[model samples]
Target: MPTALAIAAFSPSVLLDVATTVRAADLRDWDIRTVPATSSPQVFGDLADGAVDAALTSPDNVLLYAGPADNPLGRMLDLVVPVTVDRGLDLSLWARPGLGALVDLDAPVLAVDVTASGYALAAFALLAQRGWTRDRLNVVSLGATPKRRAALIAGACDLTILNAGNELLAHAQGATRIASVDELGPYLGSVLCRSAHLDGERAGGVAAVGQALTATASEILAGEHDDLVTASAQRLLGLAPALADAYLTVLRSPAAGLVGDGRADPAAVRTLVDLRGASDLRRGVDVLSAAGIH
Candidate 1:
């Protein structure tokens, strides 16, 4: 029997589908353990330390890898494939209605998950789209969606970036959606990858998992697995009747759901690269590869 491996995920929706397929195919028979987590940094750390075999992480991790700043692990890790287009709460720029456009927020405090989180990247992209430079905004690291929302409501921030169920709630509460990361286009949200150990020793299993994710995404896009999607929403997202339905609606849409090529959508790839380039997260290194049906 092979040893089990750890797999990190942020949301229940992402893990539910992959977990279901892994179980259904008896992936455990090959001696693999799946450990799901919410934090990307933790997952990345686990991957570097061999605590986890692979992870589903944002493209920002790629920026962390190919960077001008020093990364923890030098050159052992690489993204084997991008399994899904995670348009979920891709981060929306919001203000307290009548605050004028986002570009005018010169020195405005903007709430975010973290400086390195995907939400932050989206926020930067929003600023760029609004024709504002980095010096124009006072970026505040409020952490998590709940915190960001609280900051927004308590007037701790003039503007904020939110993701996931939080975005829906914010919109319902009258937070004006000045921009959506999706509007700028597709940026890489999550990916299927592993550390040097699994990348070398258990490459086949890793690829198998990626393949399963690709197939599941295809099924979702084709409406062949509506039950799986709904169940995933109910189980993982804890969404009520209305929100869950809406999420499913977006998930099934062409602009949001899985691409037909069993890889990332090209627009999303370009969006990510374009956004990253606009932001000062990296100096000049092209962080991600173009969309390919791996």
Candidate 2:
């Protein structure tokens, strides 16, 4: 019988590379399951409770939950990131249709997964660049990217940050891209993580999964799987041909895409830390090193 592995993430859209990785890693015997998450806290909570075997989440989340930070869970959980998934998914800030300039919206509502999540922090940093402070905007915690994107399209929220094909879907609905996370410097979008308390066998399974993902990323960067990626983007993400091609382009980008070798870059982790303004958390712990990133 196959060992079951449940991987939780915010987005329901599947990545083609993940399927390819499973095959390449000979994990055919592993019953890999993708669980959709409504919020970051829920994902981490499940991870901490051993309800989920692994998670695709942000590095900042690893920092916040792994130690005594003011996380929504209100307690420390021993978590670790084994592999970085993507650079930033081309994460960008967007405005509802006809929202006008960034400076024109009066107390516009900003939707986010959570107040302190990495994407939200990036949105705040980008808005600050345009002289918009957090106090000036009506920030709402809407849970996940898809929820935020829905709220943006329905005019429930005036602005939000979106990516991982959510931005493309929002753009198709007439949303306007206002700013890119690239403005924030080096950034990591997602990581494959699990509780640090896993037993020997499960821990080895997680490591193998990470290696498989890294191999898939390497193949993607090497231009060995363009057609498969494009098709998967279309089928899984519901992106149009042009948009799917664009998604592929983003995936192949060295600056803001896949981590290729699975190792989390120290500079990217530093950017995440700086964006969150939790420099004190870095005092005793090198998050990158702790996450198995050299």
Give all candidates' CA lDDT scores.
0.60, 0.80
Clashes of 1: 6
Q: Can you write out model 2's per-residue Cα lDDT over 1-294, one digit (the tens) per residue?
A: 878778888875345345445365467656677888888899998988888888888777887776565789998777667777888888999999878876666898999999978888999999999899989999999998888998999999999999998899999999999999988888889888888787767777777677777777787788777778888788877889999989888888888888777777788877887887765665313545555453
Q: Please report how far candidate 2 places residue 79 from its true position, in Å.
A: 1.4
| Cα lDDT tens digits for candidate 1, 1-294 | 655655665544443364456356645544555565645566666776777766665666655654534444444244444355455434578885446765455587777666666667778777777776667778877655656776786677878876555556566666777787677765556667665455555666665666666666666667666655666666665656576666666666655544444455556656665655544433212324432344
Show where candidate 1 strays beyond 4 Å: 1-3, 18-23, 30-41, 67-79, 82-84, 87-90, 96-106, 143-158, 199-202, 278-294
Q: After superposition, how far is residue 290 of candidate 1 from its true place, in Å?
A: 8.5
TM-score of each: 0.75, 0.94
The candidate that wins on TM-score is 2
